[model samples]
Target: MTHVITYDIGTTGLKTCVFEITNQIQLIGSTTEGYDLKILENGGAEQDPNDWWNAMCLTTRRVLQENHLSPEDIQGISFCAQMQGLVLVDKHGEPIRKAMSYIDYRAKKEQKEGIGNGFKIGGANIVKLSKSLYITGAVSASVKDPVWKYKWVQQNEPENFHKVHKWLDVKEFLISKCTNKFVMTEDSAFATLLYDVRKGKKRFSREICQMFGVKMEHLPEIIRCTDMAGKLTEGAANELSLKEGVPVFGGGGDASLIGVGAGAVGPGSTHIYFGTSGWVSTVVKKRVLDINHMIASIIGANSGHFNYFAELETAGKCLEWVKDHLAMDESNLYLEKNQISEEKAVVYKNLYDYMMDAIAHVPAGSNGVIFTPWLHGNRCPFEDPNARGMFFNIGINSGKSDLIHAVLEGICYHFRWQLEAQEKKVNTSPVIRFVGGGALAPITCQILSNVLNRNIEVVEEPHNVGAVGAAVVTAVGLGLLSKIDDANQLIQVRDRYTPDPETKRTYDKYFPVFQSLYKNNKKAFEVLNSQ
Candidate 1:
């Protein structure tokens, strides 16, 4: 079987998967390798570029060997990574320092230091914001932007900044290692906030680059997701157990590719991704920018399509935190009683099973409880770094299950908020294609569907959507597929969760309260955080 390979570079690990492309795509094998994400006390998140490369080599070799495939079996390769981070490399393509992850907020001070400011009310020059939005459809006024981090290195690490030959996102950096050509996908450029994503002119905005004192030359050439960037170099090929000249396609950022993988490539169709982070996004026909609400678009999997991204910083992570701290030691309990290995115990005795049993018993509205899922601050519907997670109106009757249910419902409420915004600003479909780690839970999908009052469909192998997208685009590059949308046949809906009228009625009452809670606490969030 002719196969295509895909690499999903995420915040916590790198996943490599292989898919066979005949009349339809079929997953052959997949594996993941983990790496450390250094979350500094001062609100910094960084990852080693070498570690990323190491994980790629490890996962690729393992997946290939397990599948009993040879180097020549794979025809094409593509990649997508968690977007909105900076990876600076020297002239020889050696990383100058650790990469700033998309969630990294170390540039907060840098946002006020000089022209690097990326957030309004954070020392950003007013004229710069107007000019940037006019030319680029985005601006660097947000510290979390890669441009702000680029400027941070310029101000704080001037020596390394001067040595920097180019700045690439996770996707470009990984592809460069294989192709020996430093290039970026259009989607990656849009995430940089320095690109002119204006409907007619899409390129590095010279004006914004000048305004931020970032040399346009430091940016790599932009290419479409299906473009054949270059062939695998001898060193990379040997490391990956692949052919020396295997073609590598320019796969896009995770936001767009995930939609393609979920079989939501058509315009106005939307998907909700819940991973280490979360967002509500849809494919659109035109570029969109609502700077006031911080709602925007990056390049999508399809060339002319725009991906309207309403980002939420903390979704699954909030649940993860709760599971790690609040949930009982199920693995240990099984280990002591059954004498099973820790890994096997974890696999056989699922934590979600435990939580879901209790959560299922709890009624809607979490027994009059509410949760705010801004554990790491927020980026969509509005950008507020000062915002934080909160559980409101708790009483003596509240139990662990109610709290757990509250967290799940809280995340769904936020999705509804973003969906409403998209319905007004961008065309959002009534049904949502749900994919990611959170969607693995049937209870989570049901809660989201009821809260949003829409159908939530889960496709087979939801967690692997990103890989599917990359594989499909690689197939497109290799002429194995007609277009991205042709991937629909390869996807199968595992189940669909419909809104229960009674539960939807309850959520309708609580959703408005959820909206007001954020606004009522907005200034207080800033003031308390400032102190």
Candidate 2:
């Protein structure tokens, strides 16, 4: 039986899985050790590219050893990685500096200025920083696309940037390590906010280039998701216990893979992922640009497929922050009782369970308390990076449970806002498929259903959907699957949840209050940030 090896390089760690292409049985598993996120003084989030490499190597070795399968048994390997990250490499394929993750906010001011009226560039241009010089004929104005955060490094840290030759995303960087080839898939490229989604081509926009001041040659070649970029090098194969010449297919951005894993390949299907962050995405047969520019549109994995991704900057992270700050004492007590020294895991879980049970007792809408789920900032519909989280209409009797419930309801209300915006552009409301770490929480899922008033289906193996999606793309690239749709037959949904009418009614009443809070507080938020 032919087998496909899939890897998902995420914000936290690297997950590697081996699967049979014919039966779709996941036979082997391993994960690389996670690396720590370095948060600098000025809101900088960075990680060493070498850490990603180590994780890939460690996981590949573990998967090979645990499965006890010969390298020849694996037919192909593909990857799905975190999006919108920047990595710089020298001519010899060496990293010039640490990778700046998508969450990094150091460029917030630059992003704001880039999208302003002077150049008439779209809001998407704000996310990337690339330089474009138009000295020659029809000189394409190349601004420093946000993908060139490394270029920013070059200007700011002359020593490190001087050593840089080619800059790549995490997906391309990892693949280059194994194959010694410089290649990045289209879906990943689009996330850098560099590629023109309308044209479906890989080239820097002249107007944007002039605005950002970034060079074009610094970017990697963007290939189709299923294209075989190169073969695994013999040295890499031996080190990871993989067969030489194993075809390495071009992998896609993690969101696209998640769409496939959530069985949202067909038009009209929507997938909502609540993990460390939350996103609501739908697959489109054609590119659906938001005239309002509230949502982010990007290329999808399947040929001719496009997708719209709407996000909540902090869905899971908000709860985490609350637990860390508000529930610290309670968490310490639990950790002491359980003999668990890790306050984060022990406290978060205990806090989450307590909050869930408490919220279950309160009526929907958290008894008139409204919350703004903008702990980080708003992404979808509003696209306000400077937005802040808030709780409105707090009563004198409000307690921990009420606050927790309001936060959950706030997140769901944000989902409602995104869905309303999407429904205006797309024809399908099709069911919302929930995936990721948050999907495992029954209360969270039910709360979401109540607020959205739609049936929510949860995939059984939520953790590896991205990996499976990568495997499917690899199979299609290798001619094992005729089309993207064919892979749908292999996907399975483990469970489903329907909305409760009573809860939905209560949430609907409170949603308007949630909207009003944002409207009233918008100018205040901007003023606070300005100070």
Candidate 3:
């Protein structure tokens, strides 16, 4: 057993968690620090690399300090972070400019335009097309991938393009600051849509890189997720107030780590996660791609497996949107009209909790209020950039509680669709290991159970699951554990939820109509969104 430290840098902020793992898992402590995301009017999203570093240092020191533990007590450090975002850094590991996020779709124009060597899918020749599918398992016509951003920068910001020395994902950039080594884990490399994963050949594709006009030297050295990146440097350790030579492991992306954290590391294991964005992911032994549905398998945190991801672009974020924007104002107005004190109106303050509590009292299907949770289009069951969120079958009787209830149901319906659609390509176990910030809510987990009609196990410390998974990978790398599968034993399931008959009946009625919304609006989505 060893005490491992893991840093999970997510879309909203950075979290540092300390875990003690042996035959059973225990989360000793965790601290989080928030950072701002810059969203431009031109469909750009960016964040400062330094802000992430500052948050990392702050949380790392806080977790260690509050626990009264010395840095030497920790065996290894690892990470999980927002993936697919492109962070370009100089030779010294300093960022050349603000990093672009995965949600940034500003590069869409460049994505469709032809690149050198016929790089992107739409621009690719027959040879390039055949090789990309065979090796990488998928390529996108959307700007979601970094390769497209690389093309975006060349045509839009040539100065930034020329100054780039190396391209790094969020985790790789952090690891470089820690070890002073410019290296990337295979998982992050694969997400760039630039690496080759034709089983047994784990290398970046030179032909693909050349086609996109990417310099081979601009990419960092590839290493296994469980491999040791290096010892933490003195300068880095000083910033975090950690031991100078603690070993750092190459951690994988957030999705893969969340899989391991929820005890879904076995080749056929499956789990569902609800974060800012969410997904249903399963572990597989080989590269599996459902190009028609846009579900792609990326490298798993476990050294030898792949995580089949059915991604949903918006999941828990919809709740946040409603909580802050829709309900907060109403909650305040209600309090004032009732003459409730700020101290007495406690329920009104915690908007998310109030919504969940409200939803718990409402029947499934939200009394015939149906919502489509496609706030940011959708990523699974189908790929569409123009899809929009909608509320249907609502009457004057429908109130805030019904709307909130419908949003939760709508998201579950989406997952139910994912479960059905993905099962055609990969074997998804009937039981799901649920983990994420949203999994803590009984209403959310229960809805998931009812809609998917599967037994669900909720993680004890749901928010820390991502960090636990990264720490588990570090444990395997440090020889504290024999293999990644040991994570199954270390992760504990706190509770289980079974489907409710009455709730399932309501969902059964609405799920079909929910599925049809996209088809009904497909033409409208394209037309209304066309520039």
Q: Candidate 2's residue-wise lDDT over 377-489, tens digit each?
A: 56567655457898888889887678877777788888888888888888645578888767877888889888888888888677677887898888889888887778776
**Selected candidate, larger lDDT, 1 vs 3:** 1
lDDT of 3 by residue, 1-531 (tens): 688899999998999999887766678999999998886755578999999999999999999999999988888899988888889998799999899988776776776663324533344445656767776776754556688777788788889888889999999999999999998988888888778877577899887787677899999999988999999999999998999999999988888789888888887788988898899998888778776677888887777788888888788878888776666665465665535356646755555665676567888788888888877667677867667789899998998789988898888899889888789898998889998988978889889999988999987788788898888888888887788886687677899999988878878988999999999999998787533
- The lDDT values for all models are 0.85, 0.73, 0.83
Off by over 4 Å in 3: 114-127, 330-332, 335-350
lDDT score, candidate 1: 0.85
Query: What is the alpha-carbon lDDT of model 3 when measured against the actual structure?
Result: 0.83
Q: How far in Å is the alpha carbon of 515 misplaced in model 1?
A: 2.4
Model 1 clash pairs are 118-140, 118-141, 118-142, 119-141, 119-142
RMSD of each: 3.0, 4.8, 2.7
How far residue 162's Cα lies from its native spot in candidate 3, in Å, is: 0.7
Model 2, position 10, has a per-residue lDDT of: 80
What is the overall TM-score of model 3 with all chains considered together? Answer: 0.94
